[model samples]
Target: MAAVNVALAGRSYEVLVGSGLLGRVHCEAYSFLEPYGQRSIPVVADANAKRLLGEHLQASFRSAGLSIDWYEVPSGEASKSWAELEKLTDWLLDRGITRSDHVFALGGGVVGDLVGFACSILKRGCGFVQLPTTLLAQVDSSVGGKTAINASAGKNLIGAFHQPALVLADTACLASLPIREMRAGLAEVFKYGLLGDAEFFARVDADSNAILSHDNTVLESVITHCVGMKARIVAEDERETKDARALLNLGHTFGHALEAETGFSDTLLHGEAVALGMVLAARFSARRGLIAQSDAERVADALARAGLPTEIAALGLDCDGAALADHMRNDKKAEATTVPFILLRAIGEAYVARDVELADVGTFLDEQLRAH
Candidate 1:
């Protein structure tokens, strides 16, 4: 087992990455639930995840002589809507959850985001734990404390920074994941390397095949490292008031736009959009003389090697660059007239560029959309 701690002055938490973590949650997170002894544990899982991995979690609770107060989150990004949020809160209220109680969020990013947000606003900030079942969630979304539901305006525009008390990233759950989803999760894993660590990027670039094959050693190492990096950044900038946390959005600014264009559906997964988004960000940086063209292509080549979509033209979207750029006008990162981009100076070195003009973005994206 490997553990990384997110150090907040008064709100610190631990993220554990390893195999069999789902079976260990009852022991690992016991302290949080100890205060409310003998009460049935409140756990909300993604419907699909419940079907697949519910038995493991149920056994964990069963061994502790506890019963699960279960709720099922509808599958997909749609669950992060106003209607679903209302439904979740109503259910929690009826379950008699208190601000002092803890709720367990199971499954991938969608479940984590929805339940984390629901807990944040439930009785004005209750506690929650993240049992992230997907590679993307286990490494990124589950650790940052950035919880949200999607809005008409944009993805994650409606949410809060309510950190989870504990995060158990069970590597075992991933063994049965479809290869497509596993590949999508690798996008976020690769983003960590792109954002800060040059050597780590090279390592993953070389070992992506092994990582995708569910190599247990490689999987746990990558997850632990990503979680460690995230822990350090989140500890430094808890609310994103500083640039440390913002740097973590290396691919998300452009990724979110692609997602918005796709209606945030299965047409493009979040990590897939991020994979393409990082490619665009890299190429755009090279265009602006921030990085070399070869470096940009290297980034694209690395992601493509892992079977991710690395080009915008391949998406075959009906919208042009201007339409995609228009989607950015309401991005969560948008200021008066600019949407700050996380641009690369080189591989493994990303920085914020706030001078980006949306019109220029439209022109650049138009070039990408037309390129092979």
Candidate 2:
């Protein structure tokens, strides 16, 4: 059992990572929820997660004499819409959830983001705990306080910075994930190494197979490492006012645009889009002589080794560079006509590039599209 503490001044919390955490919720999770008093807790989950782990989770809570009220949403990106948000909040209100009560978010990113946002706006604000079931959620979204729903403009356009009271990342929950989702999660794990830890990236390169196979030791270590990195960054700059925390968005600018191009559907999972986006960032960095072409190739090779998509061309979208680049204009990091990009100076060294020209980006992407 490894724990990473996110120091947010008075709002600090611990992220617990290990196997069999859900099964031990009675003993391990009781301390965290004790502060809020033992009552009927409301758990917001996606349909798939509810079906997979709901019974066990409820049993664990019940073992501790805690009652659970389950609320499920349809699983997918579409569930993070305004309509769903209204429905969830209305349900919580009807169930008598107050600002003093704690809400449990028990699923992947979509459920976490929606529930977090719901908690954020409920009677000004309420507390919530993140019980992330997906690898992508455990390693990335679950750790960060950033929560949001997609809008007509772009992904995560409507959201807030509501931190979770505690995060329980149970490695055992990942055993049921499909190989494709597991591979997608690895993209974010790889991003942590690419952005700041060259040695970690090398380890991932060598142990990609074991990591993908759900080796318990490797999974816990990797999740702990990523959580530790994110905790430090969030503590330093909780709202992304400084560039320190923005480094976490190493591939997000490019990835979010690709997500919009794909209609934020199954055509391209967020992690898959990020895998290809990181490759694009690397290639663009190499083009500008910021990094060696070999380094760029290594980035793509690492993702490919994990069975992740490394090229936008593979998606075969009927769009050009201009269309993709236009989607980025709606990105949260964009300021007027300039969008800040997290580009690499070398392997494990990333920096914010705010002087990017969208037209030039479009031209480069056009070439990438044509190559396929």
Please give the clash total of every predicted structure, in order: 0, 0
Instruction: Give me the overall lDDT of model 2.
Output: 0.91
CA RMSD for every model?
0.9, 1.3
TM-score of each: 0.98, 0.98
Global lDDT of each model?
0.91, 0.91
Candidate 1 local lDDT, 18-111, one digit each (tens): 9998997789998876776778888899998999999889998889888888899888888889999999999999988999899999989999
TM-score of 1: 0.98
Q: What is the lDDT of residue 262 in candidate 2?
A: 87
Worst 10 residues of 1 by lDDT: 31-40
After aligning candidate 2 to the native by TM-score, how far in Å is the CA of 258 from where it should be?
0.9
Off by over 4 Å in 2: 31-39
